[model samples]
Target: MRPDLLLHRWSSSSVVILLGFAELNFPFISSLHIHVELLRGFCSDNPRNQQYPSARIKALERKMQKLGEFKLPHFFNYPPYFTLQPVRDTREKQIQLWKELILDYCKSQKTFVIAIEEEFPLFTNHVIERSLTHEAKETFLSALVSEGRAEWMDKGHRRCLILWHRIQDWADILIQFAKDNGLEDGVVTIEEIRSGPESQGTELHGIDRTILNRALKLLEQKGKLVVFKGTSTDDEGVKFSI
Candidate 1:
């Protein structure tokens, strides 16, 4: 058989095998299991194997270690990972995975920003020479936008602000900081958090000014914090109540 034909045959059989698992009616676990088995089959069937199933499983296992919920391992050198589907159920799962992966990658790397044309390490697989096309990247990120977990950084989505940690998380961080640092009843300049030595090297270090402001505003709406201005936008301070 031609190498291409052999691979194609293997892929088709794997899909059938995956569907067999998916067809099992065992509730939540069935879907999860199906996804896992599908990944297993996909990895195992690769002709490049020197160690067969063990090597494939180990490779995927390592890839998945870096990802969080709904996120798959970085090993999706396969082309299917990039395509957004019209199939309702599959699309939902794929979207969920993309959201989780994007968030995980951003949070761990402290990537607060994502650009459409830029090469996101999360979106590329040099091991297989595959990268997300612009449309695919937008599709995944737009899913986040719809769910209130992401936003476009501009009129065009060429630039995006990824809220992997979310505004609520940012608010929680502020609340915790307030409680920990005895700022609950006191006030300090926003610049102090954004640039002062106090926040340096912490998660707050070098945070984008806009994200900091948004997080503060979220806290303000809850009446847990108040923002007051003194000299400039950078000099704004917050007073937290309890």
Candidate 2:
């Protein structure tokens, strides 16, 4: 075999091996080069020189645009965001950004609940073909739970209750809602508070039942309301005496 041909074959194999390693998320990959000696042996010239920075930037911009209310930082598209940063400072920033993004997404979308095994739109970026690893998802969600902004619905952490608004805040809102509807000393069913015409066009509309129950319990403790049990568990009602 010709010496030049052997070199070409070796370089091609080397490039493919390095790319495979990268795809597999190997830690050692700083040795891959794009120079002629590397690509001239096997790969074409045009693709080596074409930088894809713009693709990443545009992909990130399109994602934020699609999210509508989830405004991402400029560094969101900087490639490294997809990886778990090893450095303490960088990892802290990354985690903080993820935390803020999750809360902002939940708040804007009125998403009170998130199941880890379910398809949550914020967990994946389709344009970039990037999705959060299960570990990453749990890590970010745990951070939110630590800060009291979220809670695990079960011990296994399979589901999460995202409280973009605190229970106290929600309770206050419910009290104000009741007052606005002239419901002081009036009775209202749980279903009515969730889906009735009076709740329509308000934040209370389609609220998660669990969160509503927590808010109601808070008000009940404060003597603002009395919950009455019914024949069916789903038919619980609240009588406001405020």
Candidate 3:
């Protein structure tokens, strides 16, 4: 150790020395000791951490982005993201956000069905390694069903089909599309529109059968498409009319 450097460093701050000395002085010493004792007591009982709030706020920000609402982030700032939400309003709002995000993501990706048992893109935050628990997924899907935008294709919500566009909207699209493709009074195989060249790359592509059936039923109720058994064809097909 260099004596000159040690002297220079020690002499750097007079205030630090004074403050240190003040802690030993009788009047200031008692106050400082009381404060230290209080702090130590508090720490021993329950530590006040600065990290807890910062981590909490960051998680809140992520959930708020899912909400896509104009309100401040703290409205939904809660600790239960790690624990599944249980309160009715909180769970409702949480489910609403999840539903909206799922639909929005699907609309962007043209994903018409969400397999509840499968890993969904928005459900996992790989950076955080957090995902919706199975129960959370079911709750959100149930919320969508209550709103008519999603359906449980099976009794078990192992597969929930999403419809960013409602079945009514799809029926309208079918009517317009039938007119566009000159099927106003014509017959086409269900498979042809579902996966064949004519439906390639269209909204009709990659659509779940249950969703298609719902849409078809919607149109049938409106007298647009008629379902009939095809004895000759392998697929019992449908015919459409304007």
State residue 55's C-alpha deviation in candidate 2, in Å: 9.7
TM-score (C-alpha) between model 3 and the true structure: 0.61
Error of 2 at 237 (Å): 1.4
What stretches of model 2 exceed 4 Å from their correct place? 1-64, 68-75
Candidate 3, residues 93-113: lDDT per residue as tens digits? Answer: 555556676787787677777
Model 1 residue 136 CA deviation (Å) reads: 0.4
Which candidate has the top score in TM-score? Answer: 2
Error of 2 at 24 (Å): 23
TM-score per model over all chains: 0.67, 0.73, 0.61
**Top candidate by lDDT:** 2
Error of 3 at 85 (Å): 3.6
Q: Which ten residues in a row have the lowest lDDT in candidate 2?
A: 27-36
Residue range with the least summed lDDT across 10 consecutive positions in model 3: 70-79
User: Per-residue lDDT for 70-106 in model 2, tens only?
Assistant: 6654333223455576767656767887888788888
Model 2: per-residue Cα lDDT at residue 48: 38
Question: After best superposition, candidate 2 residue 141: deviation in angstroms?
Answer: 0.4
Off by over 4 Å in 1: 1-75, 200-202
